[model samples]
Target chain A: MKIRVLVSLKPGVLDPQGRAVHHALEGLGFKGVDDVRIGRTVELDVADETSDEALTEMCEKLLANTVIENYKIEKLG
Target chain B: MAFRSAVITFPGSNCDRDMAVALEQVSGTAPLRVWHGDAELPEGLDFIALPGGFSYGDYLRSGAMAANSPIMREVIRAADRGVPVLGVCNGFQVLTEARLLPGALMRNASQHFICRTVGLKVENAQSLFTQGYDAGQKIQIPVAHHDGNYFADEETLDRLEGDGRVAFRYTENCNGSRRDIAGVLNKSGNVLGMMPHPERAVDAAHGGTDGIALFEGAMKALASA
Candidate 1:
């Protein structure tokens, strides 16, 4: 089974990298860009029987820092 | 008995020797250098230090990979037993990742790696690490890091301030850490994670000896116990 995990800073958390890119985009004359937030995507291949609880555990334990980030797991064929 | 200390060295740890030297200078005995792969730490350790560096090359997240190393299991156990642990810079990130400390270190607000000596205010003079400094005393320490901006939810931040868990605050907000918190102590005050490098400031020849008090304070606490 193929799994995709998207990790992102929680709402209201300040993301300096995302803000810098936002500034650069504006400097290049791009308009109407209200905000930009950067995140990470992790892909994994696991046994088809991998349980949802196990995957959630992985996120809580290592894939994402629950203190400042949130993670979503997507099951793709 | 000479104070026993140990410094854990990860694959990319650059300040392990400096930390060992600082420990030796203060404790009067060389600290044991332990490898990250070692599952068990030597018994009878009075103090443990996780020095700063790009551990695991700062992959995934700063200190993320190193937090999960084999030796962390032992570190965590020792911390639970009330052993004092100090984590500086990248080591601070590892402690947060290991859930030994609260908050996460993000990129600097200016998006630039900052490296310079900055002023810090000692917030909690009762902690083993900060007891050497007078409460509210301002001291100069060097901070060098890209992702040293500390972040935690508002409630957690409030609790930290209310409970006197904050050990040090930057005199000037250099990294955008909430409440200018440059360092924090765990609930029991046994573990401390800080962005500034006290070990680097221990010697007057290194620019200042403001950091000597921290090591001396720890030794005094251990000796009296």
Candidate 2:
């Protein structure tokens, strides 16, 4: 099974990197961009029997820090 | 009896030696060096320290990888048993990642790696770690990190404050940490996670000795226990 995990800072958390990128876009004359929030994608290849619960556990245990970030697990195939 | 302390060193830890030296200088005994791969720590440890450094190259997140390493499990166990654990800089990140402490350390509001001496107000001097300093005393300590900005939900922050778990607060708000928190003690008051490098400031030759009191306080408290 192919799994993709998207991890992002929870809303209301200050994202300095995303803000810097947003500033850079404005500096380059890009307009109409309201905001930029950065996140990471973690692609994983697992055995066919990988369960949704296991994936969620992975995110909760290590893939994402629940205190500041939220994670979404998607099954690619 | 000599202070039985240990300093856990992860793959990229750079401040382990400094932490060890600081412990030895204050406790008159060298701290045992433990590797991240180790599953068990030495017995009867009086103190455990996680030093500052780019552990695991700061991959994924600062202190994230090292927090899940084998040794951290033992460190967490020790903390639960009331052993004093001090995590400095990167070590602080690991403590949060390990869930031994609350909150998360995010990128500095300035989005730059800050490296300098900053003023700190001892918020709770009753902690085993900060008892050497008077409550509300101002001291200078060195902070060096990229993701040192501390973040915790408002409710948690209030609880920490209400319980007097906040150990230190930045006098100048150097990292934009919520409530200016520079260090926090766990609910039991045995574990402390702080972004500032107290070990680095222990020697006057290093430009300050403000950090020595922290080590001395812990040793004193443990010895009398």
Candidate 3:
């Protein structure tokens, strides 16, 4: 099975990189860029028997810091 | 009685020697050098110093790999017994990553590496690590890193500040650390994780000896205890 994990800073956490990107986009004359938030995507290949619980455990344990970031799991056929 | 200290050198640790030297100079006894793979730390260790460096090449996150090293299990055990642990620069990252300390070290807000001496305000004078300095006293310590920005939720931050766990604050805001926190202590006040390199500021000729008091404080307190 193919899995995709999207990890992002929780809302209300200050993201300097995202802010800078927002600024750069506005500078490039791209209007309506209210704000930008950054995140990371990781793709993994795992045994098809891997259940949703295991993937959630992976996110909570190491994929994302629960203290500051949140992660979503996506399974691709 | 002379103090017994140990400096743990994880693979890729560059400041282990400097930390050992600083401890030796202040305590008048050389610190035992321990490697990460070692299963045991020397018995009767009065102090443990986790020095800075690119441990495990910052894989998975700064200090993530090193925090899980064989040595850290021992560190966690030692800390639970109240042995004083000081983690500077990269060592601070390890402590947080290991869950021995709260918060996480995020990339610099400016997305640039910071390197230089910055003024630090001593916030808690009662912790074993900060007893040498007066509360609210500002001192200089050199900081160098790209991932030194500290992040924690507001509730956790309030608890840390309310409980007087914050050890040091950056006066100049060199990094986009929330609330300009430069260092913090564990709830027990026995473990400290600070980004500034106090080991680098112990000599008068090294620009200033602003950081000397921290070492002396540990030695004196442990000697009397």
TM-score of chain B of each: 0.99, 0.99, 0.98
Candidate 3 Cα deviation (angstroms), residue B198: 0.4
- A1-77 per-residue lDDT for model 3 (tens digits): 99999999999888888998999999899999888999989899999999899999888867787777889999987
> With candidate 2 superimposed using the best TM-score fit, by how many Å does residue B223's alpha carbon deviate from the native?
0.8
Clashing pairs in 3: none
TM-score of chain B of 2: 0.99
Deviation of model 2 at B52, angstroms: 0.5
| Candidate 2, A1-77: lDDT as tens digits | 89999999999999999999999999999999998999999999999998889999999999999999999999999
Task: Judging by DockQ against the true structure, name the best candidate.
Answer: 2
Best candidate (score: lDDT): 2
Tens digits of per-residue lDDT for model 3 on B1-225? 879999999988999998988898888999999999999899999999999999989876788888889989999999999999999989999999888899999988889998898999999988887889999999998998989999998898999999999999999888889899999999888999999999999888778788888999988888888
Q: Evaluate candidate 3 and give its CAPRI docking class based on DockQ.
A: medium
- What are the Cα lDDT values of the candidates? 0.94, 0.95, 0.91
Residues B44-153, candidate 1: write the lDDT tens digits: 99999999999999999999999999999999999999999999999899999999999999999999899999999999999888888899999999999999999999
Listed per model in order, the count of residue pairs whose N, CA or C atoms clash below 3 Å is: 0, 0, 0
Global local distance difference test of model 2: 0.95
**Proportion of true contacts reproduced by candidate 3:** 0.63
Model 1: how far is B13 from its true place, Å?
0.6
lDDT of 1 by residue, A1-77 (tens): 99999999999999898998999999999999999999999999999999999999999999999998999999997
**What's chain A's TM-score in each predicted model?**
0.97, 0.98, 0.96
